[model samples]
Target: MIETAILTPLEEELFALVNALEQFGFKKHKSLLGSLEIFEFHELNLLLALGGHGKTQFGVQSQYLLCQLPQVELLICAGAAGALSNELEIGDIVAATATVEHDYNLKFVNRPLPRFTGTPQVIDTLKQLPRTEWDFRLHFGLIASGDEDVVTVERGQELAYLTGCVAVAWEGVGGARSSQFAQKQYVELRGITDTANHCAAADFEVNLASAMFNLAKLIVRWQAAKDYCAV
Candidate 1:
């Protein structure tokens, strides 16, 4: 049975992890979901799927993957995020214990914005991991998810204020939503590629490689340190 499924949002992001996983014998295969890229490693009964580029894309693909791969007990959302906190440096990771769907607000309709949280076991596992294995730092905080590009400091701060997030990304809420619906364990580990400032987009392009590599390296390190499938 496939015990874990890793859903990543971009081709570059997927390859960064796949390249890292190759040393452990993971290999590409014909995807059951034809539109998605799939990889498998038999010994661990692990699978990875390319979930496409945005929140909507990720939600649709992940929901389908969970339905088709019912044995998958854990879902991981991995990729890059813009830092909303001043302390975050490029290549740092925000292993969010909680996340907010900032764009899902309904204040006009008299409803509150939704927040997603939990996965304490996963947090504990990551916390107990050997720091020597990773070159980057880990920060546990709230991650804000929405469709906004968040290229300006003003906008980023606004999101940070509204959602109380340390990092902002396009796909975390969708990832969490899918896991919630599937009733599976979930966690999101995102690499900080750029600070959400005026130069955010340009900065993201410049730092993308290192951030993704570090993030992918962390995943491989985590897998080796703990048997996520067992508990």
Candidate 2:
């Protein structure tokens, strides 16, 4: 009875995953968390919902819902991210070994809160997934999440230097905080869609749709594993 919680921050990603879940024949029980609608797949008690950009309020609401579930053991925050390093290509997945709030700093004050960072626990469930199931390559590194998007090269490098994080995204921190505080195992799956270069790269347009689609497929695989073990 291992319940899993899947959260996406964007509507398009949520819709894609919901539709794909239906194709897998799972009926979603609907509910609302403030203004956000959450769909729970009944058989596995897995929760699905969106946490809009830097929407810490919505993320907190969603986590409260997950807390109500008796068996939720894992929390997955999956979505698109912009790459900061040259080695990463579009559509590749970066599974975070650790995560931090890169935007938090103490330059204006004596010191910031001590809770801004940590060594995230490794995701054992993701590790159990057979490597041949998907065509995506997975990298383990520090994922920097914050309220702002890393749209500029200078900002990206600065944040990376400040946090010693390899990549940055807009929503992972809020989602990560709630999940970790709730005592659930957490893992972030970021599909790289844009480079830190800022300028629209020709490859970005070609890769984004596929990255979104593939992310859905990966979620389905995760759902299947949880669904299988429950039986």
Give TM-scores for every candidate, taking all chains together and pairing residue i with residue i.
0.90, 0.78
Compose the digit string of candidate 2's lDDT tens values, residues 47-105.
Answer: 78786657485467557756666477767777777787777777777878777766676
Quality of model 2 by C-alpha lDDT = 0.69
- Give the alpha-carbon lDDT of every model: 0.82, 0.69
Top model by TM-score, which number?
1
lDDT of 1 at 138: 90
Write one digit per residue (lDDT tens) for candidate 1, span 85-160: 9989999989989878888856557665777784899898888877886778999999988888888888988888
Model 2 residue 66 CA deviation in Å: 3.1
The alpha-carbon deviation from the true structure for residue 183 of candidate 1, after best TM-score superposition, in angstroms, is 1.0
